[model samples]
Target: MKFTHTIKAAALVGIAGTVALMSGCAMSQSGDLNGMKGGGHEYLLTVTRPNQLHVIDTETNKIVRSCDVPGTFGQGTVEPSPDGRIAYVGTNKWEDVVGFDITNCDIVFSAKQSYDNVTVKSFVSLAVSRDGKELYTVQNPTRKLNDRYEVMEPQLAVYDTSAGLNAKPIRTFPVDRQITKIMAMDTGEVILAGNDVQAINPENGDIRILTLLQNWKRGDSWTQPDAFAMHTLGEQADEFILPYFTIKWNGDPGDMEKAEFWWGMSRVDLKTGEVEQGEILPFEFIVFNFITDPTDSNILYGAFNTLSKHDIREKKTLAVHNMEHTYYDLNMTQNRTIYVGGTSSDISIHDPDTLEKIGSIKLPGDQSTSAMRIAFLK
Candidate 1:
């Protein structure tokens, strides 16, 4: 009984009364529940640079603990609160919020809100709400005349981490673009996708813009091509696929070889945008995120520097698994066995029901950072 959230800036009439009490409620379709028996395994809450939040224990995977996220957090990622005790970290530094402590990982809480002062940065999407108390972040409002895509700011902020340690007040939801994937739907609503993928109601963020495709190709000049990841398998009126990742950028210099660096994956029907017939997931290092198998929502697993798998109803890519060093976020728990963290800090363990590789754990750093997001502290 400790979630004391109170962040406010919201009032679309309480998001239309919580979307009319979650309109019909039946959205529970995210299960394959592999239920592993491996004891206290799966971990890696990392950051390297001058950034910090390390705790890797992927079944003896390594690096027990390292904390101190005072706030410089960027390109956001870190989640907990399904009774895993407490860990809801989302920051862009200025609108800071970080809290941790599930059996002594420390970082109890640190929130700072109130700043519509304008010009803000840092945020690439973060979610945690299904009932783990409350903590959702999505920021995208930059004006550096940028669109080279470094991913940050699309605007969305909601915090109520049980309102503990004086929690609350950072309520916002402003969008026009740049929310790379945010899902906190447990009949509560807030399943935003980006480049343009919407579903909002963080108690009153009330957004509903889902249009599967119109510009997603992803990859070029090095990457920033487009289409990263978005998941919402089913429920709330059934029928949900909505996957993403695409890239395209026509060049013009008389002959830039017609410019096109191919990469694809598509599935959308968010109640009639009807775009089916897309599949393409291969990587040479540039696919930063992908994970779906909250049981078996058609089984999808990606890490785009390589560490892949997707079967979204046989749409394509059943396995891509090529790692001795290459992974940076991959999760599936409720017992479906699969936890992979990367940047060569190494945290691998698979078998998300037959994507089988079985084991790996070696994180304490030797080099390489960013792209390590995992949670499971039962």
Candidate 2:
């Protein structure tokens, strides 16, 4: 049964109750699950400018399909399904999590974050379990009533992936505000990283503060860490890396020479709950984003006016490669092909080992990428 979902704002209460019930139980549908097993090879999906998702052929560097996501556009992250057949896109304007089918270039699922007077947007961070049973997200909300807007509390929401299209969250638990990112660990604890890192038990909404940067003396006179890169070491790797940068107050904030910027990285061992964070770079220009080399944790690559290859142990850049423009999203494919995209309509490919320019894939329609992911389609 197809649901058009056109309802009056006055009926929100009734719809909320209905959604709660449906969230627990998903009515099974008869459709093609064969594709769920995967057949296609490597493909790239980029959330582009002005509300678009461009699917590219990684081998040929050609756009095979451009998926249209109406009414949304922003710099956010994309989470690929375990099977790599679908892509979950995070967008604030639409206030919904859209799952796009890369094979067919269609929207297979959409979970709306808001209805009626209530509006909620997930903070770029979206996660699907390795078993593919659950979807985890942190939602910041706003409510409108009597023609006035009121900021609401943020919450951690979990959805049953099997729960068909447009499924509401099965459960939502109140969490502290200003959480920017969340990653579900194999231990069933969701790591919420914002001002601080926390390990939260999603089942009961119990939060345990793992560390306080201020107390630990991680940095003196620094800025907030940006936890945007969602790269992992497949299902076999044990360590997780978090990258960010901070500005230090030298003298006057306006004096560039007096003030210094530093790049930092945190390496976390999931099983042991051990975290080691240190300043990786003494000076930073414009390292907008970075990703740790899954194969070698000592190495990391970041994008900006120049591509920087850093030695995590030495806390310095091993090599630097200039770019045409600054990029935001950076990732390495399973085959070890590095891609940098975000600031332009094209994705620049490079050899991860040599840092040499491999080639470039110009996307169709001249759209700039906000978030791009390298997916292996079985």
Number of the predicted model whose TM-score against the real structure is largest: 2
Error in Å for residue 361 of model 2:
1.1
Q: Which residue runs does candidate 1 get wrong by more than 4 Å?
A: 1-42, 45-56, 59-97, 101-103, 112-124, 127-136, 139-193, 196-348, 351-354, 357-378
TM-score of each: 0.29, 0.79
Candidate 2 local lDDT, 26-127, one digit each (tens)? 221233433332354667778766677877777777777777875567454677776676778876563778777666555556688888888887766677
Model 1 over residues 1-378: C-alpha lDDT tens digits?
233333232455456535432331111112111232123344546555345567665555556666656666553345555544455555555356677663454454545553444445434355667676667766544444344523444667676664544455458766656555565655676666665556788766667755544443433433333555532222212223334443343664333365444445544433444434354543334555555565555666666346677765655666666766666555555455666664555567778656667877654452243444455544
Worst 10-residue lDDT window for candidate 1 reads: 24-33
The C-alpha stretches of model 2 lying farther than 4 A from their native spots are 1-41, 92-94, 214-240, 247-261, 269-274, 365-369
Any residue pairs clashing in model 2, and if so which?
A: none
Q: Cα lDDT of all candidates, in order?
A: 0.52, 0.68
Q: Tell me, what's the RMSD of every candidate? A: 19.1, 6.0
